[model samples]
Target: MGRVGVDGEQRLLLRRAEELVERAERSGRAVSRHFYTPAEQELIAGAFRGRTPLTLEFDGGYEGAERRMLLLYEQGEIRPEPPLTAVAIEFPARAAVPAHRDYLGSLMGLNLKRETIGDILACPQSPGIVFAADAVCGVLYEELREIGRTPVTARPARLEEIVVPEPDGILKRATVASLRLDSVAAEGFGLSRTRMAALIAAGGLQLNFRPCESPSREVGEGDVFSVRGRGRVVLTHVGGNSKKGRTFVELTCFLR
Candidate 1:
């Protein structure tokens, strides 16, 4: 709990862990609820068939610890996820992914790519994935910000940290590291386009946070594209990759 780990002594482990939680609460850092009771300790070792070794999470956000606790339900005690899996990224400036909750849970099932960690997150209701290494994640974050988007967190940002705007708020916008969007919006905003004309005629759509006459407009990073009676969006560059051997752009957008 406090850098000091327990060995074979169960009593010593519980004592130190309780102290750590107390310290965390006082310091305003994330805290861990009560876990690892002395009586339950022996049960865990015995149920796994003669004292199986247990591993604590580097961070207590993962439910791997809880899965172990569930063993307790059958024998020792089944608990919720451990702290290690809770936070996927820890870096302060990184870009997030538009993954679903099941995606995170799938990460637990599948082995992570080297230097990466994956986990599920709820509340904001999305999959949570973060890099384990700071340097790599930091690089990704800087690129996103440079392109005028929010940086993702270091293996600690939860899915709730980012989200897609609701249908009511989806406006055309681009993140950093993305290409031009003038042509893309032209049809949607031009007077000839019946849909665009109707929406614009209603005077409810805004591009780059400005109420433009039409949808055929230039949009880039830091642009707040909005549709009246619809929703707004903030674009975050998510870097580039090859899809079918072709260059592809990725970005995260917040709707509504």
Candidate 2:
């Protein structure tokens, strides 16, 4: 398929998400599922945007999972949890493994889309992958060959049972003048408003993973945004106004 622009991709993903929601409602089963990038997950949530009869949930097996899988269902279906299977791929010790790239490449070599898999936790002992059970669990458990420079073998496991290293990221809290995206981003990242405006105007920033050139756009709490060459941050909370009437926002910027 040809590359779709950000707007096109967002529309397409929203449509698919709604379709899944409708299917789940009609079938009365929690049988609908889709893999979503962090940004796509945000888009999907926006598709259902307010209080509705739909149930949408996300999980990547453990806390602070980056690439999450989205599960959709009606209010009282089986459950909103996607059918996930944890596959721990064991490799020889002393084998250098590029967690994300290597395991992802091997899975793609199996003709799997990146969405079919969730977080690929790279542990020194072994790396684990959370895969959508309906499509990839059996195939990978039966067929994965190698990951990067390490010979690998897979087996079924429980996510809660595994102890993996924390994700490679950091969290920081900052108080900004307002929720205007560029302004908060500027403060959190230690850039001047002029520089931030320049970046936004140059199409070097993304609001919730979609291209956003407007610096004055209002960023709500819980929105994850990125600035090219600077890294990504999540607006963890929107607090009350500051002493001088400025908006108080708390955000965590993930280190690149």
Candidate 3:
């Protein structure tokens, strides 16, 4: 997914979101846009801060989705269905399972914008589900035939057909000197402090869904650290200090 930085493009997206809300208010109808990354969603929400009586809805075709579309409608107006379509891509049982990037790469190869697509549920042994904009479903069904050399079949599916796999997480309880990003992330991800620091410096980590290059940044309970290849870890709890003065922390690691 594309990351929106503090640049012209970010400004344009925020402006567009504001325009959509304003249009909905004036027209007394619903207006929506394509999928947005978590960071972009945060920016939009912040842009509308202090604006009361605004009815905004975010949906990604399912609950707990990371990428979602934004909807703005009048207070008493009936909410319209989100312009979403679920595409199921089935791979041959004998074929190697494709990773998330592979599926995304194939879609991008079809000239689809990243914003038009939402969460991709890569099933281990079943058909993978892709939530996308309704406007792109026809192209996907017609042109999307292979995902990184793996032959596949694409078909439209109901939103309920998506089977979200259970998160595979490893629980850990460890003691760290402090709640710094590097210390807690290293202990949780089983990497050395030096390596973790290097990863953070190289833009390989995200804190709370936004890129964070500061290894010394303090972390708190519920902070999530995502490493590019190592998946993500959540600082679920903070405990009292150990005898050696190290603070105890609990983490749940979900490896990719």
Candidate 4:
């Protein structure tokens, strides 16, 4: 699924990437674009593979972020900081905790492009932090006063102030007939094989951060499977076959 077909959005993003690279090369300086999802970033990477000598760097406001901005620079140019800022939305202690989608929805209501926003970390009983482009920090600070009827105080904060919680994952070991995407994903996500296959066919599954519609796709040890509305699972290890001729596998499941 990595740049297999150039859709309109992918083509536009690729063109922007090329323009940024050309600008960086011409001016002998670093240039960057707004945030991009992992899929978009992969597309950009595939399009530029071995095609340009410029160095490419990606960074979100924090480490282990799914959405990040791309930086293009030369070998000796001084790399500029990523134009990212953190907006902390503090909910009242007694207020019901807002879901991630709630925060994102409120932001979108402000007429902001999705690309300008990064990750929204919803911390329980604590201030939720949103990583957005620096250009929108003022608007977010000024107008973002509520999320889905719950009043919240939004303020711009330094990136260092963001505190991301550790991922909570449950480790499970299982044996499957094969390492097909459906087989491993069903076991890891506690779903029936039929249901998993249907989910894949409906474009609800992502193999290694790219939407995959093939349930029979061979999955490897390091492959990650993500299902929207469910959670993410990583195929951590592949071991020897069992006595019943089933392949042994370990997975780390992160439930939403």
Candidate 5:
């Protein structure tokens, strides 16, 4: 849920969580609140029959579409249509977005960096904003321009297709180029680096199922790296140089 990847451990944990949920239900602890009482149900039926506004019910954990419906209900009858910004597409990858069509809706371009993205998203919707998922960030700028929008960049340059996930929980991931190991950890997880050496350590963290355990390991550009608690990070290359002639790196932070 934090970083994104395919992990058998995650599946096992989810399965266990489901088992616990079933046990809780058997104990009469889990209840659905979307159901209405008799009077409310009758009122809802009348509203549906007469085309009146129905007081809809929803569970306590409503989100996305459900959350929107509840808020609209609380705001009273539809009356005149409320203002809505045109749909937007956002490019949030460290890589530049490729060119593509909305094929769906209007496209708006807002200049923003990979950082401070949340602030741009919080503004009221406008015709020029297409809030895209992370998947769209590697599209070509010229391709995007032909479709009537341009890619915003931190620096002026033409980048290539990274073929990376949006990191938003929907897309399946492939390989990442590189990863970062904390210099100050003083140890691997809790074990000493030397002591942790020569162990299988197969799936603890990997790009495409290759063992990458050394504290000095280089994750490479475009690698999908996962740590147990740190979540998943994509090793996106920006630009870099040698520090005292030792290779230093620049990477983009893709939160999962």
Candidate 6:
């Protein structure tokens, strides 16, 4: 693995990379690792591809989580533990229920970074809110006292223990003159075409959670755009063109 100019964290990642390689070679079995950011995941993947023939596995707690863990395994030789565990928070029904902000605040207030936690499922219909975190889950269950000013109770939970809600976002339909990345993003996000293009050129946005600066890149259905100051727009559908020849697109905008 590349080690030049590596920091402590990068060195740790490389060590884990080495371990994954060593374990596979020693036992002829799959090995797993945790706490990798998306960027880190890619870095490790690139590193592994250069050194071995083993396969890489990636999964966050949920579909759209920004941070996830990586599992390295050999063909037909892997059985890994679920990298994350859920915790349920119970509060008085009448009390004000805190949203992601509060839950996140409470976690970070304890010196936990956002990467240590995963998707937060909070909905009005759900009796309790649940969040995913690393397997070392006792801290959240034991230390979190309240969400903002409202007191609450939290306990360990399985995925089946709670009902997950649709991710937080607003869905809308729009028509764009072209399927070019900039055009669809501008229409879906309610921004002027020039502004969208300008933002992209200025490196102020990301496509599919990865940094992207090209405005003319085509945006198909299910593509996600994360703009720095504005928000995120997910292209949900691409229908046939209108009589005027504009493409009809469905999008879901998730505010940051």
lDDT at 103 for candidate 1? Answer: 42
TM-score of 1: 0.22
Residue 16's lDDT in candidate 5: 41
Better TM-score candidate (4, 5): 4
Off by over 4 Å in 4: 1-4, 158-160, 243-245
> Candidate 1: lDDT over CA atoms?
0.36
What's the TM-score of every candidate structure? 0.22, 0.81, 0.82, 0.86, 0.23, 0.76
Whole-model lDDT per candidate = 0.36, 0.72, 0.87, 0.87, 0.31, 0.73
lDDT of 6 by residue, 218-256 (tens): 878778888766778889999999999999889998875
**TM-score of predicted model 5?**
0.23
Clash number by candidate, in order: 48, 0, 0, 0, 32, 0
Sum up the clashes in candidate 6: 0
User: Candidate 3, after superposition: displacement of residue 64 in Å?
Assistant: 2.0
Candidate 2, residue 12: CA error in Å? 3.5
On TM-score, the stronger of 1 and 2 is 2
Error of 5 at 140 (Å): 36
Worst-scoring 10-residue span by lDDT in model 4: 1-10
TM-score: which is higher, 3 or 6?
A: 3
What tens digits encode model 5's per-residue C-alpha lDDT throughout 1-256?
Answer: 2214426654454344334335433542322212222222233233333332322332211122211101113224342221211223334444233333332211233332321111012211111232222333334223344223333322111122212222343222222222334321112233344433333244355332233565456445565444555445444442443444333343343333
Worst 10 residues of 2 by lDDT: 1-10
Q: Is candidate 3 or candidate 5 better by lDDT?
A: 3
Poorest 10 consecutive residues by lDDT, candidate 6: 125-134
Error of 2 at 187 (Å): 2.1
